[model samples]
Target: MNRLAYHQGIHKFFMMLGLALHISKPVWKHLVHLVDALTTKRFSGTLTDVHHWSFHPNHRTTLSHFFTKSPWNEERLLEKLQEWVLRQIERLAKRTNQPLFLSIDDTICQKTKPSSRATHVIQGCDWHYSHKDHQMVWGHSLIWLMVHTFTQAFPFAFRLYDKKAETSKMDLAIEMLSSLKGKRARPVYVLMDSWYPSRNSSKPA
Candidate 1:
């Protein structure tokens, strides 16, 4: 598709998505610009990068505040997204007689070590052992859950692994799974790495 047509198509898609999610039109307009910037090839996932790449006239600060200060409830958005994905996949899985699959994994987003003199470092960033690198890495950690059928996959849910929080990685994994309880009619096979198959996790769900 031509650039203009592609942009228009994306705009319409997000409009329909926003309506389904019950986002106010004004918030959806700004949200669409942010989403547009995110989908761009050269755009990095940052407020500054989003503002630079987006076609909207809003300043960078406005974009930042749109997240930090906006009254919109992100939890609501996520819940709606998960509900929509479940509906589509559940329908398709039944039609194709495909058993659903759920996978859980965690990853570390490594960031530069903050200077010793720096008083305020990024919140929720800490040193965590990287199984891939076999060493401690300083960054935020995240755990994600994805659901899939034979032909398609969806990011069902995720949780940031906060060391300071009361929850363990296993607890977070179980929590994400718990949210999906009683929501699916199809048989789902849960998949995880060797690290996740502990005594607690080995128990029948």
Candidate 2:
């Protein structure tokens, strides 16, 4: 299908961004197909070979490679997204008098199977204790920081939580909060769950 033509509105917006400049044509083609498949409610399966022929000439293997072992800098893309989101927020903040709410949370995303390819190959996929599931699940641990205005909650900065990484979630939250040192919203209030508290017992949540 000519998804670009089919979804011209979204396609034009994506193309207009400086973010689109970095992607090569072949990679961009697969990326667009993946976006189309993912956003559609009916085609909700893993981007594997089952739906490969339905879209275009590229195989599922090619698409999988674009996610993993690909040379693309997803971090840079995220930074671009951050830039774009803040610009939108700036427009809305001028109209609202509410203090911006910066919320932080972490969740466990369980894998299909313990030893599945996703658990092995996907970045940040691992064993984590899921309080929601009440089990040790093999999958990704994800943490995100979101900005909540009166009408919207925009999840902007997200990072994979790996205990093997450089720092703890507490540290990362602090770092993320620090990044908003001089936001247009004054006195940004941080809303975190019970899990996050000062290590010292004497302090309040």
Candidate 3:
């Protein structure tokens, strides 16, 4: 089967298992389209099509709209996704009899201009030597935490920190660890690069 079909099948299965409800089939289909667009890096086309298709007469309103208009929040959806991921990891741990490894790192998504929505304001710094430009350019920093899955060799669980804040990447890593704590029987080993080495700037974890 094709990728789109596989995604649709999984969506149907989840719906049948009662894990996804209150979301119409059409909205779900659009959401799958959105995911495909994101995966394929077709951002402009996807945004245009989503905006056009969403307002059509036959298209149903998305869950995001309802939640924003009503009292519902994203916490429940996030919790469900987390639970599903943990369950999958548990199954893998039982099958392999090995501990799970998580990697934490941070990078800069450089932006030339500032926006009002950005939070945690902090001064930009240049961590790399630009040989081509002969000068370093300051940019905002982003921290991420990743998990290595049994099905995939690479790390997942990447979180982006776009805001300019005083919070250390270590703090974010600890929060992610705390969330996954007690969720598995096997051990979890977190790896970090030299940028995240034990430092006086932040207390040891």
Candidate 4:
């Protein structure tokens, strides 16, 4: 295929992802542009970078507004994404007669410590231990659940570790896993480090 056709195909695939979610046409249009920009080779991973790489006619400010004020429901989008991913992975597992894998892990999104004089810091930013840095760092911790097969993997869900909620990372992991209780079509294994498997969490629920 020619370069333009290949790019168009990729964008079309992204557009199809939201079709089942019942999002507005404008939101769908913006989503394709954003996905295209993000998946571009050498993407710098910023909205401005998206503006530079995107072929859509909307201005960067319009894209920014889409994020801040768009009527699309993010939770619905995630739910539909999970539904689509589950369908795909289940088909692969059943076809190959392979067991599915559910992997749970947490990572810190490091952030700069605000100055004492500063009135407010980013909401949800706090100190979290980073195994990679081997020290406590100021950031938000995210718990992620991924589904893996012998051939491929997909991020299934995620939760931000909320300190004020009085919920531990293990609890968040369990909650996400619980969401998959009756959803799997094959034998599934849960993978995690020693840090997450408590007496309660270790048991099959």
- Judging by TM-score, tell me the better candidate of 2 and 4: 4
Error (Å) of candidate 2 at residue 152 is 1.2
Mark the 10 consecutive residues where model 3 has the least summed lDDT. Answer: 51-60
Best by lDDT: 4
2-96 per-residue lDDT for model 1 (tens digits): 34565577668765555545776657767767777888899967788787776667777887777778778788777767877888889999999
Q: Can you rank all candidates by TM-score, best first?
A: 1, 4, 2, 3
Better of 1 and 3 by lDDT: 1
Q: What lDDT would candidate 4 get against the real structure?
A: 0.81
Task: Report the C-alpha lDDT of model 2 over 125-195, residue by residue, as the tens digit.
Answer: 66787787777777877778998777877878866777676667777677777666454644467799775
What would the per-residue lDDT of candidate 4 be over residues 1-205, giving only the tens digit for each residue? 1235645775576566756447877887777677777877978777888877767677789988998898888888787778789889999999999999999988888888899999999899888777788888898889999998989899999999876776888889989998885756699899997868766543121
Query: What is the Cα-based lDDT of residue 197 in candidate 3?
Result: 54
Model 3: per-residue lDDT, tens digit, 107-132? Answer: 55444444558675445543332334
Local distance difference test, per candidate? 0.80, 0.67, 0.54, 0.81
Stretches off by above 4 angstroms in model 4 are 1-7, 14-21, 115-120, 181-183, 200-205
Clashes within 3 Å, all models in order: 0, 0, 2, 0
The superposed Cα distance between candidate 2 and the true structure at residue 24, in angstroms, equals 2.3
Among all windows of 10 consecutive residues in model 1, the one with the lowest summed lDDT is 196-205
Candidate 1: misplaced stretches above 4 Å? 1-7, 18-21, 195-197, 200-205
Best prediction by TM-score:
1
Ranking of predictions according to lDDT: 4, 1, 2, 3
Q: What is the Å distance of residue 138 in model 2 from its true position? A: 2.6
TM-score of 2: 0.77
